[model samples]
Target: MHSLRPLIALLSATAVAAPLRADAQTFEPLSTCVSSLRQELPAKVKPETFETFTRDAQDLRPVVDTATKTQPEFQLPIWDYIARRTDEQRVAQGRDIVKNEQAALASIQQRHGVDGATTVAVFGVETDYGRVRGAYPVIDATLSRACLNLQSAERKDHFFTALWLVQEGVVRVDEFKGSWAGAFGMTQFMPGTFAKYMSAADDKGRVDIIHSVPDALATTARYLRGLGWIEGVPWAVEVRVPPSVAQRWNATESEHGCLTQQSPVGKCRRVAEFAVDGVTRVDGQPLVRPNSLLGQQLEPSLNAALLMPAGAQGPAWLVTPNYQAIWRYNRADAYALAIGLLSDALRGSAPQRTPWPTDDAGLSRAEFRDLQAMLLRLGHCDVVVDGASGPKTSAAIRDEERKLGWVETGRGGQKVFIALKKSSAPEVACAAAVPASAPELAASAAASAASR
Candidate 1:
């Protein structure tokens, strides 16, 4: 649901455009699927509803399969991920939305016990202030995923529930369109979440997140509250970690501390504990201050996890449980960080003081595709070159790193690209020089000439 494009051009290219419906087909796979749904859903959903909806269902395997393979979370670097979501232009636009919708946001916050800025941040990031609610039909997407077994059991259940919602007339089938993942409306609520937490902001009793700003914000606020969002706590605070303190806290030495295997963002420690370790707010001020949100509302005893997105040399943050609430909206760490940073910017906070510690900075989609191609040629990976650095791609990178005697971080960067280019150049040259029919002979002749 949280799609971040690198620039405006990319955003326009990928932005939700006109709906592309699948051509009608027999959809043979869904026959048993509908029968299973009829048996499984009747207790909660009426049997009549299930029977009626299945009559018109069509296959959408192509669209659903393509989306499943290309999610940005596993591909984009942390910096690129955050930058695209929390761009300066987006922040400025969000601030304007906060100002224009002040009364509605304030009321939603008061009722739901969630902050206005955070709600706006969700809106801004999820759909770019509702400018790009996805163009895929909800029924087509959900039913396709359910019938084709595109996701896990629990996720398929959600898709089935969405179909049930359509059948029951809770959301009209024709009007209900959203992302390929089946999350709908302005804030992108999955059917299960919508069924549980949908709320109307006006007296009409119509909760339309797709069309109404107030309703969407209110629904988002209510959803966050259900996720344990504390009323006034800051999601995260940028921090400065002393060199000596960082040296003492080795990320790989223990499985329990910050940035460990078990807790990649570190375990939560009390603010006092961080103070003793010489960690301070990034602004060179005390962790608690009169004007700060923590000083105004949160207790000193609150625990926060230390997060370093780009290893120890990069910017650091003390992320609170409120951060977890944001993460619940989307499970990716980069997504959560983008929301937090965007929310901070809306409140007039400055950008990160410390830059990410990498010479190459970030990978473009083209660069990522090139990396995948090189890995494939080297016999390290077998995935399609779609620019997404998924599990197979990461494993391949680690394998290549090991071959080069480099540390196996499984990260894609300029160094890896350069090394791969150098390693592959001779092979490329040799293949280009020899005729395809007599490659072995050409190689043998070259070897003989070298020996002579």
Candidate 2:
């Protein structure tokens, strides 16, 4: 637990460590950053190669800046995070993939210790099962990240590695496009990670995660194995928190356990310790002494942390090493939890036992689309029915929230959905139409999105 202090301190510093930014350098004159990198470029990445590829790279300052600050992982409530990603609609899609792609996934699992369900969960979450692999060019994205944080060697490494990929013909220059952070392809592998885990899944002998599903899934399985994923071992299990235990630890959560990263989540306490302290499975079954195979293999030396994401009042889990491995894939609790729950959903396993501690539960994509449709029908906001909650949607939600005499949360929560549905179809069907508003008001089109 104590060993993570230095790293936590470093992360804290790096979060605000862009001292190179001056009042004048507004992240423009890309050459200022690109020029400074001549000496920092990896030995394999030549200057001519850098100049040839990045000369016309578009500046993604606006997108990258917003993305870094408003990443869902850092900003979203845990329930919203899990609910939005692991809804029944997405789960059904994943199960179909598991059924159809069983042979390919089975081959990859035979090679790597990762499972089809978990790998497909990553595929589903990262790019909506390869449907939306981002729009930014890899060079532009990585360069933008590097320019944003000049002190980050890792960011610079990513940029140079992106160049190297283009130079080495790992991917076509025109085809190297992905997320704002330069993670590309079906499973969203950054340039560096792509290099680390790039391998052909089948006997085709060519690697193309972008165009091929097997390559993408196999690459993901390899990456998970590299990160210490254990097949059949549960990543987390829900547990009923004893009132006494909750009372003792709830107040000081941040200072004690995974909430603060003071203690690593994977090594918080032995299962026996938790059982001694009155922790039990959701069904009241006692955890085995030190060794456990309750659902899957739980090693004797393994430790488990009680993760009450929304404090003692909400759902809790004893997250394990498999969860830690997923965390490495994307270092955020929201993201990891989404992957975990989505994987469970893929296998048709039990859903989350406890609900989030809120009257207005988070909306799924389908539910969000329903909310968007309501917004359009009632002339609340001109939001696109794409189901994504963007700035324009947030503005609309805030406006409607004010009209409803509710505190403006800008969330398309259950309350908002119900209220909007009621207003969209006010009872008194077949009754005389109350004097309609202006024709334009009645025909308002909501084409934007709101917060979750």
Candidate 3:
């Protein structure tokens, strides 16, 4: 037993050290992320090329840090985030960009099968139509993240891939400044993604994405093609599910891990059976079952996964394989959904036919303070409201959500905020209630409160 205890102690120490090792991932600074790689890189590059990468990486620090910390906390809700991109203003602007740049976008679509909407969405999202590619030094941020060697293996890969790009002379160090994530040019591709998908030649001889609009858009299309993007199928489609139905959905099974980034949803045992719209197709076709939906049909066969990010009462979607392709661009469902929805909006479609329950009322700062008071009174939270949601405020909001029959998204949303404003106790009150974390609701609640 004593021997077992020491073994257990050693195992615990290793467990603790593992996280420390992971957190050790830090910024390497552009110079080091590149120059250091010459020692291990394929020994074919000239010594002068290595020296050039070192110099370029050193100069890229300013650009990298600027991009990384520029928006440490993105506060836009899915609805608002999707809405802004798909709004009439943006759609009209996209149309103009497309009309003026048709020949270029069409040529790219022909070669890569990536449509203008996807191209535009990428351009709009990456740097707001390339108006702001970022003010950071790409080398510095890449090096910083690579050196920190923190909990990011993927980022480390990006660092070295950047070095490869320099050695290959695909892009000189001077012209390579971009986002901290190494997502550069109009389409925002990380160095590794760029290295993999960037074609050396467009219809024109230029392979450069930094200066050439045609090359960049085409390169983005190539990336989508490499990711198995379907040509004509929509990325995602707006769906209407009646209140009587409950739609249960899950992403395809993954041997690697869960389909989401926030937390793992566990292994997929079988395709989860979910509710569907009882109504049939526009042609008076019978409603297709979820199981049958997975199989191909005579019409355009689209393998889709239903997504309901804002709980059951919010907007719903049937995201197709192309949607997953967009998700491959960025793992966040919200981001992919935004891109997919924006694609639809750019094509001139209204919001989902299903009515979103958005009119539950807003939570003001004072009201939030009151909600915080109730939470602290119940001993679930020991922090002040201050009209801001730090960790404790979120904890309090989660406690409140569980009290009501609300869905427990840790981040604060309008529903949780409204529920907090009402201040009603479940049958058992706080003492008897089991407190659970609600990060999503508290996150949103903090935003709403702080704005006021």
Which lDDT tens digits does candidate 3 get at residues 138-207? 5555655555443455665566676667777777777776654455666666676676677643445547
- List the RMSD of every prediction in angstroms: 13.3, 8.1, 13.1
Candidate with maximal TM-score: 2
Query: Model 1, 146-264: lDDT tens per residue?
Result: 77663356456666677677776678878787766667787888777777788887678868887888898999899888766788787877889887766554222122233212223
**Steric clash pairs (candidate 1):** 258-266, 259-266
Q: What is the lDDT ranking, best to worst?
A: 2, 1, 3
- Better structure of 2 and 3 per lDDT: 2
Sort all candidates by TM-score, best to worst: 2, 1, 3
After superposing candidate 2 on the true structure, give the runs of residues whose Cα lies further than 4 Å from its correct spot: 1-25, 247-267, 289-294, 424-452
TM-score of each: 0.69, 0.83, 0.60
Report the lDDT tens digits of candidate 2 across residue range 37-116.
Answer: 87687788988998886787788766556444445544455666577789888898899989998999999999998899
In candidate 2, position 188 carries an lDDT of: 79
Top-lDDT candidate index: 2
